[model samples]
Target: MRLGSREVGYPHLLAAALLVAMLVGVGVGAGTSSSTYGAFNAAWDGGSGIRGVASDAGAETQVVYNTTEYETVDPAGTVAFVISPERGYTDAEAARIESFVRAGGTVVVADDFRPHGNDLLARLGASARIDRTPLRDDRHQYRAGALPVATRVAADPLTRNVTRLTLNHPATVTANESTVLVRSSNFSYLDRDDDGELDDAETLQSYPVVTAERLGAGDVVVVSDPSVFINAMLDRPDNRAFAAALAADRQTVVLDFSHAEERPPLQVALRALRGSAGLQLLFGGLVVGAVALVARRGRLS
Candidate 1:
């Protein structure tokens, strides 16, 4: 027997209530998240974040989350801060970023504690490599495992007014085209075995952790560690000063978040197809025809 209007309406109401509750739960979870990384993620405070960088320099910051491509942004004259992306960029996106840098924009790529750093470096024409081994300096360490304290740093505007810099288990970097910005102490060694103790087999010498390269009218800065921008370390020594100098420009600062967008490739393709006006109208017509057929029966039998 066909159900009455009241009976069908009751199920609809129940479903609507359940959906509302689920949505509310999701909203609350999103508000409480305190992710240390990811573009435009403001849940973290001074804990692996660049919000301090934006505030100290008095620069307008725009987070790139929904924007699929870098070319969507106008990189006329500004700084692009890309820190510790979980994934590599698409070819189109990489080309756009390179063009932005070559056209007088500044780009800062900082990555450590991961394997994704070289994705952009390989395309940038710079042979600089981020060492996989952890750089350790016992004498100047902030903690075990050689969280080195940087005292012997390069003389540059970015390092100016910086007295103390306590690095995490930072990776080492090398490049012939770039100038070394931060260096390890001579006594430092790489923990090749993951053991805290320095082994004779491990390389014992200072290495570069940060470097900057100038291309065309732009500059590209690469740092071995991205945790230096975290909120917890920004106040340590002259880290805040260091971060402030990166944003010391008149143009806006953009934090690229597209890398962390976790959508699958198939879903991305579907969304692209849905963007077409013809497809939308075709789908709309089909929906209307389905509704008309259902109405002709006087109910969804």
Candidate 2:
């Protein structure tokens, strides 16, 4: 009365195929909608090992940029902000931003001491130092592990919701009369090698991790740790609340996609599609095996 493996597997395989088809249909629908903002949206959806605070802020929140290829702007009431990881700025772009801010635009600059982020720092009237030394802190270490803390901030609108902040593998910023938003305790110092490994004996001086300075007619906020804004890290109450507080009052927010560089959309899409395909194949194989077994049993009976 026993059925061979192949004979039992067919029906099970057919069921699996049907299930996979249903799932794929749902996935495709979700992926093609305006709601899907691609990789940046994925990063905000808690994918980039950092959590995003603005995900729940509103439905209209979007990422903006000034790259030669794409410039996205929303006419509705929403926040539009630029994100740049570059160290230098082109003369034309600088003038455009300066003019925008002079007209009461708000720009949040996030960088990690990379050369790409330098020009933005200079424009903000601050200098950045790539810490070659490791920072150690006994007081400010996260549950995951210890991280280098930077300068503390004075009271300001940008940091109003942020009482304490953490920066993982961060660079340091120094400026005269700069309002320190969050700082590493005296126990913490910069880890310059940036190997994510810190040593007490090799500690450098404690410095600012996030700071804000007043520029001509607008304001500039600088962050040394980009990890705070990533999807995984942004979920932390402190980080999320801080981001919400930073953008709470702003009417328009721009997320600069210029720093994203160039990558093929089809390649990304194919990768996503592959996951669905694998599931379909697995389901089909299981169904076929089950059907074959059932058929063999019927024949024996």
Candidate 3:
């Protein structure tokens, strides 16, 4: 084709097509995400803030897409964050996590309004259980009653420099065996009926929002609300401090997304490509061909 007295060769046209296709692929991969709590998601409710927090604390951060990776990771210097899993964990997967914790790995289970969290706790033989009921505070709240503030922070490594924690639609943690690190104010009450009020059945009292318990040589820290580590809530000073504390002294921080509802398509595709030698070779050949086409067109020009 002739454009303003210049001829566009077939090689040039083919190279341009390849480049445009590559650019479109890259754009689509970056713009699409179905995950809610995905570490790669930069949206408000995503856990991307916690990933930055871990990286800022000088910890090597990674995301675990499969529970099989749990067996390969070194437990001694690692901390795993299992937050708001929408899917239930398998018996073997739960056992794998339990073994990871028992073998001296720190596992932080931050969940609310999910039966899967309690199920995993039971599987791990943890004494702490997450109450599914939503805890609301009328007095010590952030912007609304649903978003309560926990002023009672205990002296612990996880609660260091954290005077108050802001929670979002959180549940109360009940633990007879674990050490309570943070608690809601006495004005907080469990919204059993979801009426958003202090009803006749509900009474205002302090409830545990964060707890830590020792299992073997490792530790299991449970946060009643996973949203505390999300991008929206991490803006709160105490929440950010609390997230930093989770990665403190840990060499590796892992965001466990094995049980999550959605996984990033780009990450999934990359993992699949990495595992297949044929795919890699194919992509390499295509890249080489595209370069060769451009070089040939330049020579012809």
Candidate 4:
């Protein structure tokens, strides 16, 4: 390559490409994740759409990679979402979340067939509990009974315009009837035996899929299925509307990924640098030094 009277080598072009790639990675927190419902995942089953929902509602979206950061969040103006955690929280970790809720922060726990979400709910002293069995509706569903369509939505602020919710492999929540926000139809039955057929012994009944309870000055909202918040499922207008309402009035909406199995590497590194003034200064010095050296070499040429 020729630049004015000077010639550029192939090595220089390769270096430029590498630098561009690195900047792109740093800009977007590039990394691959095998875990579902990860905040950074752009995949179909991921929860990345929730970030967009928060942004569209005029709220700041924050992805918290550590539960230790929970104490730093201002409970007065933050709404936290804990979705499909890969691992259970310790006593201390659960207590931190509980404190955040009790101090006037809202928390939404969306999970199914996992003990982790229920464990957190118990620690929060909330009466809501996600059942182990998968709820199926043969009458009211999108395609199959496994994917039930919940039309029994409560007329709450969060579900104001939401008419129906399409669920994927959801569970039922066992909570006080008054606290229920969404429920399965009367024809729906719990697949306790994992069999598609409803046996004569198992009677069809209405079960709660979403519930909420007041905790001190805050609120705890439980959704039996976490998949409802995923990217693919958000295509449903009602689902997207409900998610938008959750973040609508909040100043800051947080996606808690502390118990997640994986995270974007660049995000973690940037967050670490942001927390440390020394590291930021050192990184800045290196950048300035590299630019000065390059300028000196150009002048000599």
Candidate 5:
């Protein structure tokens, strides 16, 4: 018996629906996996954004956190990551992060300060004291012709692949018994208040901006300022190289998605699920749906 047009089209519609369901199922399953989730965040002042972008570029699995909503986001593993302090971390949250690090999980805290003074610095076995004096240098200069600018590394894995880095009126950082991956030049000194004036009498010598420490079975990396990896600055060659290196061998990278103003778990999941078969299926379903709709309407006129 010859089937009517509506009846003939019903199979295509059913096929399309089934394809969509299958795709969604695959996507949901893939999204739930550890390899398919990326979390990150940007601070209100744009410091965290730089750092977050650098980290995201190099991470296999990353989460960005810049808002309070992410505080409740369940970390896939033992690590609780915070990229920038633009959103600020409470004492309790810091304690939790510390616990996560101690439990053989990595915590990367990037901010400006001395090696041991800053609260996060202390947690990472470093201190952070702002150098309220201007830095003097003939080698590097800011856009405003300021001297002794803070800089990132080109040879280190954490920063070697980072092509660009942002530095908000940053202060040089210092660390003890930790690996200093990046440093300011000798001519550079801290200008803590950022008044565009340097005082040799009040200057603190070249300090560490980024450092790494080993804690128990895990490690903590601290950056003096969060601006070294924002999206705006990431286009720079040095920052991009540094970011790539940092993300190179890591199996799971977290971005502290809780820190961003917008938290989209699905977006994180899709990015993380880049190479998954489920993603392939999802795309395939989308193509199939489009074709089916087109075919259905083609014969309508």
Candidate 6:
């Protein structure tokens, strides 16, 4: 069972160990999830995971796997929170989402970029699009980070118990809708130039960070920042209060993961780089080592 002066064992064991290692790596990767860019179900991590404390609603939380599956949600019985959904929603898919709100269900869609899942907002009769610029309020924030601290909460029912919020790289949510639930402080302004200075071209006034609108029979709440739901921000100020307020009226909560960019041409290349490339290197090493070991030993004849 030993070779190479008792330094090597059966070649088969080495091969088997390699296979098991690869499988274990894949399983762990799938379970914990990588929080690279488009991650939403990252519940185990505190930096990018929302499951830290937000996942403890103690209610039936279902993730919409596909656009068609979103139809199963009962408008009057669920509080669906779609956070920063990737772009592209078919006409039918958009209609179904709007219908959920009209049916007296509370649909909170928090987005941060232009034309990126803004189709649903358009479907709900709102013409506003999310700006990619990171809104900041250095005067009223936990630290000098890009996160904006919203101190001026409106007197709406949604912000009833909530006083201040710690938003992570929030975008400005500008809409014709007059019911703005939360606004960045008077000193806060969009750093469009990214120079850390408020210029004359930029309006030195309060902008909407969260806005609510009425559609048909239901209502839609839009927040500028989605990072508030992350575990890292839950303990700050009244973030938990805001999160609790959103889930208060509904019997169910649906976190839509299907809306993200699940497949891209670039991702195929990345997978090959990680999986195939690594396997090739391992195969080459095994082949070279096997030939050397066999050459060093004489035949059993």
**Candidate 2 lDDT over residue span 1-301, tens digit each:** 2255335467777898999999888665544322112233453432222113444444334433343311233223233344435335676666666555554555666656465655755654544433323344655667533453333555766776666776665666664566767777666655555455556545634567666665566666776666677665665647766677666654445555545543234434554455487867877799999999988877776
| Model 4: residue 158 alpha-carbon error in angstroms | 2.2
Tens-digit lDDT track of model 3 for 1-301? 8854478899999999999999998877664554777788888877788878988999988788888888877899899999988888889998899999999999999999888888888889899999889999999999899999999999998887899999999998997799999999999999999988899989989999999999988999999999998898998759999999889988899999998777767778787788799999999999999999987877777
TM-score of every prediction relative to native = 0.73, 0.62, 0.88, 0.92, 0.55, 0.72
- Cα RMSD of all models vs. native, in order, equals 6.5, 10.3, 3.5, 2.2, 9.8, 8.8
Residue by residue across 69-165, what tens digits does model 1's lDDT show? 4455556557887878777876777777788888777788888767666887777655676877788888877755567876667778767776656
Pull out the clashing pairs in model 3. none
Ranking by TM-score: 4, 3, 1, 6, 2, 5
For model 5, the run of ten residues with the poorest summed lDDT: 33-42
**Candidate 6 lDDT, tens digit per residue, 44-147?**
32223333233565545655646565577777777777777766777787777777777887777787764654677876676555666878777877776377
Q: What lDDT score is found at residue 168 in candidate 3?
A: 92
Model 3, position 230: C-alpha lDDT score: 85
Q: What TM-score does structure 1 among the candidates reach? A: 0.73
On a 0 to 1 TM-score scale, where does candidate 3 land against the true structure?
0.88
Please give the distance, in angstroms, between residue 300's alpha carbon in candidate 1 and its true position after superposition: 31
> After superposing candidate 1, which stretches have Cα over 4 Å from the reference?
1-28, 31-34, 39-49, 66-69, 72-76, 261-301
**Per-prediction tally of clashes:** 5, 70, 0, 0, 75, 0
Stretches of candidate 3 exceeding 4 Å from the true structure: 1-34, 276-278, 293-301
How well does model 1 score by local distance difference test?
0.71
Q: Per-model C-alpha lDDT, please?
A: 0.71, 0.54, 0.89, 0.87, 0.52, 0.69
Q: Please give the TM-score that candidate 2 achieves against the real structure.
A: 0.62
For model 5, residues 53-142, the per-residue Cα lDDT tens digits are 444554444454333323443333323445444455566656666655666666667544323236655544444333333344445544
Write model 4 residue lDDT over 1-301, tens digit each, in one string. Answer: 9975579999999999999999987666555454699877888988888989998989888889878887887887889999988889888888888889989999999999888998898888898888879899999998899999888888998787888888998998898632988888898999888898788767888899888899988899999989999999997748998898788788899999999978878778889899999999999999999999988888888
